[model samples]
Target chain A: MSEWSKNELGQYEYAGGKEDWEKVEQIASLCEKFVIDEEDELVSDEERSCYNCRFRRWTKSAFVCMRR
Target chain B: MKIFVGIDDSRRLDGGGAGEIVSLLTRTIDEKGWGKSAIPSRHRLYPHPDTGYRKHNTARSFSAEVKEQYMEELIDYACVMIKSNGTSDSNSGLAIAVPERMDNTDELIDYAYRTKETMINSDEALAMAKKPGLYIFELSGNGKGIIGALAAVGLRMTGNDGQFRGKLQLGTGEGYIATVKEIIEKSHIEQVKNMDFENLGTEESVRMGEKVKVVLLDHQYTLMVFPTDRQHPRWQTSTTNMLRIF
Candidate 1:
């Protein structure tokens, strides 16, 4: 949803930190391209969460969705 | 002689991960009789924006048993494997360390812990790589991956860090129950301990959780179980939430 905003680099970064599990899971659950990342890179307990999406890039505070 | 090999790749659109690359390297060495290698373990680094690898802040490493004469051959194979697999935009680095030749391993371990908490540059990593028994190389891109490659070897040296890249299939599936002895015999897990670090008896029952995984602890593949409400099988494999600590 609108929880994501584009930064100056024209990348869509999650508004909150990585701990916003509910939002990320909901977003990933809706996205058609939510491919699971490598098992080693997974952070969230949810298997299909955006935090586990291969296209999401981690920043200092939050993550940017490269697929966006 | 024993050696540790580590590699890091800063991949953006690449379909596969560096773990697969390093895992292939491990298998190749074993297949070639160059060494006997275990599965690769994955290490996490600081994800500070300044570090520049926003795609994935992770590295992979594995330990091997090899003859001292094969060190050069091993390094050459690693360089070729990494260079050939890396994408044009990927920045990859490889690090190999021989603990027997190092003057101080604790210092290297300290650097690994620091890399997990802060940003480290290529020059600093390269400087550390100049140690007597360590070798590091930047295969592509901006070469910042050397930081992670060096840190991964150090982290693996700690003997209590990182998780192996894949899962261990000891049981049929989730909710499968087995005793401590059975779990150990079925997989490479060396020890079965509860979350409190207490050792479980051979007869103690453990219920496999949604995912069965192991972590490197005390230089062994340790399967850590968590307490559950069930009485018959009170212990179960740890979940991903509980395992992210590694």
Candidate 2:
């Protein structure tokens, strides 16, 4: 597995300097943390923050962060 | 035969107010005569009934119902068209759009399951889809439209075990490049493993600002990207940037 650098918020950025990869991981993590594996089905701050992030945008049905 | 399109009111709103996008799409279809061969019908379901008490309480229920009806109509129309045409031709398609604000991902999953149930159990719709030439074009929205459609059609997210994933297909052109650049710049991030334009689809990984064409294929669906070099100033903000045929 490749190593990644985490920012102040515990968000991970890719070591190769690929921002889209970082964005994709951030989004995937957010989905895992807030949208998936929960009965309540609420969008948490981490997920919402991802939505507001530059690498990502919220879709009508899903949160679309960049993927490479 | 019929074609159905999902309309989300919020995204249609702008400085001029809501309904502009819908009007534009309707006009384009009308002018182009795309759906003229088969009758086109629309059903508008609000998040809340116009004259209901305590709109907040009924919002979820109302949205669910609207989505349910929309999916049912698409299935119904596809079945009719297939039976009449005797094949799963290009004409048998459904186009859908959703609002950006309705981002409850679980609700979308639920909606997909329900759609699957209806399709599996209905004799009429199922029989018509014997060949199952169904195409779903998810217009740009909050990304939920495509995600929901992908889930409804059973595309699981790979590598994450149970997690679901949806992919966006962009055409090779300046517009697509601009879109990628905006996504990267807005995302506040950097590099990707591969950058070759021709090898994009085959590459194991892609970068933030690469140009490529995407095709989605399955037994029942085919999504194709046709590149147009002309750029629209509003394409970035417009939800109609992408087209889905199902």
Which stretches in model 1 have alpha-carbon errors above 4 Å? Answer: B50-53
Off by over 4 Å in 2: A1-68, B10-18, B37-133, B138-142, B147-246
Per-candidate TM-score against the hidden true structure: 0.94, 0.20
Residue-wise lDDT of candidate 2 within B1-246, one digit each (tens)?
232243222221111111233334444444544433111111111112111111100000001113333445434543343223322211122223232322333443344344323322223223222323333432332222222233322211111001001233344423443333433344321211111112112212222122222222221112223323334321221111121111
- Give the per-residue lDDT of model 1 (tens digit) for A1-68: 57888877888888877788888888889999889988888878888898888888778778888888
Give fnat, all candidates. 0.61, 0.00
In CAPRI terms, model 2 is classed as incorrect
TM-score, prediction 1: 0.94
| lDDT, residue A5, candidate 2 | 45
Expressed as tens digits, the lDDT of each residue in A1-68 for candidate 2 is 55344433343433433223345446456453322211111123232334223332222222322322
TM-score of chain B of 2: 0.23
Instruction: Report the Cα lDDT for residue B217, model 2.
Output: 25
Q: Name the best candidate (by lDDT).
A: 1
Q: Report candidate 1's interface RMSD in Å.
A: 2.0
